[model samples]
Target: MISYEWRGHFENPEVNALHAEGFDHAPLADDWWGQVTRHSLGWVTARRDDTLIGFVNVAWDGAIHAFVLDTLVTTAERSRGVGRHLVATAVDAARAAGCEWLHVDFDDHLEPFYFDNCGFQPTNAGLIALGTSAPRHV
Candidate 1:
């Protein structure tokens, strides 16, 4: 069975590994998960048998809005309700924190998952690139 934590400690590198496999991104920065903890209102981690399998980051604008970011699960654990559980935990955390809105932005391929499974509504949104690369951020 999968277990979860509303954490007081971070598993930064392990979470980066999970993110790398789950999102098919190149290895993320070793300290990236640290930044997530520093910025988050709260986060939830999912595990089974002491191995990290999933994570979700709940970041806020310090007012009424909270965004769900970097929801991930190990490739072997996908479609097994890990994503759903992580998002649900994040949403619950956001609500408990008194956030008035919970938002998420995801790629097209994940629309059904976000909409059908996680109950996010479709809305008009936009993105603007302010730099060629976030080279400093990685």
Candidate 2:
């Protein structure tokens, strides 16, 4: 069975490994741990027995909005419902935290999967990218 854990601790090695695997690109500054803890409420990981298969981070503005960020399942683990489970769990957490809505900015190429598999739909009014005048956040 697959197990999920909401972590109070940051797994730096796992974060670095995922980054090296091309699933992440954020620069890990020296204060990375502090920054992550300050901005994020928790991280969740999917494990099959002793191996870590996937992970995601959850961020909330505390009062109003919540965003799902940096969710990744290793390529080898794709299509096995791990992604779905992770997303469902995130949705539950968002609802429990009193968020009015949950949002994630995803790859345009994966629209079909997000819609068909995860039940997300494109809104009439889409997203905006204010390039480089602000720090490029993913």
Candidate 3:
């Protein structure tokens, strides 16, 4: 069974290691960890048998909208309810914070999953991010 907890206890290297295995961004660089812990509404992790299996995060202005970030489940733990649970947790947090909307910028493939599973739907006009120019490729 999976269980959820706020505050990832990043001091635990195992938790950081697990994230490395499953996420686009991982291993929880010190600056990233500090920023997320300091700026996000809260961060959550899912665990089974003391091993971190999944995680999600909510970032909000603390009074309005909240964005879902870092939603991921370890390969070994997918196909269970971990992703749903993470979404549920974010939803609850957003509602509690009096957010008018919970927004996510996800890959096109996720539209259906987010819509059917999390009650999210495309807006008549969705958001866009514009920059003067793309940053130099690493």
- Candidates' C-alpha lDDT: 0.84, 0.70, 0.75
Please give each candidate's TM-score.
0.88, 0.76, 0.78
lDDT of 1 by residue, 1-138 (tens): 888776534567887788789778887667855676678788888988788888888889988899998898888899999999889988888888899999999989999999999999999888865687834443
Q: Count the backbone clashes (under 3 Å) in each candidate.
A: 0, 0, 0
Candidate 2, position 108, lDDT: 81
- Top lDDT prediction, candidate number: 1
Per-residue C-alpha lDDT of model 3 across residues 1-138, encoded as one tens digit per residue: 778877655554654675677655657644546767779887778888777787787888877888888687888887777888888888887787788888887778777668877788777656444676745544
Model 2 residue runs over 4 Å out of place are 8-10, 22-33, 124-138
Quick one: RMSD of model 3?
3.9
Ranking by TM-score: 1, 3, 2
Model 1, position 94, has a per-residue lDDT of 87
- Model 2 error, position 31 (Å): 6.4
Off by over 4 Å in 3: 12-19, 24-28, 124-138
Score candidate 3 by TM-score against the native. 0.78
In angstroms, how far off is 39's CA in candidate 2?
1.1
